[model samples]
Target: MSDLASPPLRRIQRIRHELHRRDLEVTRVERLSPHFVAITLHGDSLANFRSDSFDDHVKVFFDDTPGEPARRDYTPRSFNVQRLELTLEFALHGSGAASDWARQAAVGQRLVVAGPRGSMVIPVDYDWHLLIGDATALPAVHRRLEELPPEARVIALLQVDDAADRRLFPEQMQVQWVETTAELQAAVAALTLPEGEGFAWAAGEASAMAAVRPLLVAKGLTKEALKVAAYWKAGAEAFHETLEA
Candidate 1:
């Protein structure tokens, strides 16, 4: 197959392990924005819960319907080790099992979450970090910004539909908030990268992120210094559909 027909290459090989499921309780729910919902879940069952990477995700099962439970994947945004409280943010898009749950999630609701199974665990020692993605990828990007060293230079190139969806980013970090448009690929192409070794991470629409890979490589990032994931596709029902290939 031609390069275009083959799967996109990744910088680091990911590791996986069998993950055990945990039952959780919804302790609180807050609307972070018009398009986002923040749900906090906690329980003693989370005594051994762990997710050490910015992009770690857990499978959430909900009983929105009468049949087999509906399932969705979500990033584990924050975990309070001391309190054993885990927070997960959901993007409220069109009606779906996950979106439906986030819209009406209330305190006392029981939820079952399983596995981050593994983590990528990108090192923070790089000269700089490049973060790019849409709203679906925001929680992970924000997690990176919050976890990285304050001195670490980060360039955020993000795309969101409404202004209300934008969150408060640090002043020191360079951020480019692009209104939802087709020019995102062009914007990434025009970035003036700083000197020294850098790492680039992006997640968004499949084809759009695929176009960013060669550009970062041409701008001095090696294949080992880049990580791009397709969080969703325009016409696909599930995000993992691409992973099956």
Candidate 2:
């Protein structure tokens, strides 16, 4: 046998939280872009809410649908424990229960949000970071960007419906906005992995993310240093899955 040993993988902590269902009222609403809406919810129930990861998702319940209540997973964009306020950004895709509710969301509207369940806390000390995804991934991408230190090196490849959907991120980070998945794939394929250890994170439509995962691996990212998820799937409701090698 060869005497060489593999390098140690970076440790990613998994944290579980006590599940809580919070009934909150919309305190504010803002049109973030032509395709995004920001809803701020406030209630005493959120006093102990915890989301340790930028990519953590919570279930939003809607009772307006006939028969069974409709629920969808949404990223907890931001939260303030002291104020008992939480903000969620909804991607307006023209349909779906959550989208419809967010489009018509106004002050005083009530909403029930459930657990993030758990969090995968990725360390920030990596030599570099890669963020890839589409419009649906905006909230998580924004959160990660804001959470990273000013000096941390990051490169984000985001696909959006239009130029109008683009949002500003830190100037120090390289942000590439693409209009199609093909372009996103091209961008990923063309990228040169930076020196030293790094982490790659991606989330978006099912098939698109499925396609992007292998490209990152081919670029030399190990399984332990990557996370690719399907935030939604076309024609499927509340679809979310993590693609594993």
RMSD of each: 5.1, 3.3
Error of 1 at 78 (Å): 0.3
lDDT of 2 at 173: 89
Best by TM-score: 2
**TM-score for each prediction?**
0.89, 0.95
Cα displacement (angstroms), candidate 1, residue 137, comes to 0.9
Q: Which lDDT tens digits does candidate 1 get at residues 32-105?
A: 99999999998887877888898788989988568788777788999997888999999998888788888999
What is candidate 2's CA lDDT for residue 227?
96
Across 1-245, the per-residue lDDT of candidate 2 in tens digits comes to 11121242779999999999999999999999998999999999898899999989999998765778898999999998888899999989768788988889999999999998999999888878889999999999999988888899998999998799899888898989999999999998888777777889999999999999988887767778889999999889979989998
Once fitted onto the true fold, the runs of candidate 1 whose alpha carbons sit more than 4 angstroms away are 1-18, 241-245
- Candidate 2 wrong stretches, greater than 4 Å: 1-8
lDDT of 2 at 175: 89
| Global lDDT of each candidate | 0.81, 0.89
| Model 2 lDDT on a 0 to 1 scale | 0.89
- Which residue pairs in candidate 1 collide? none
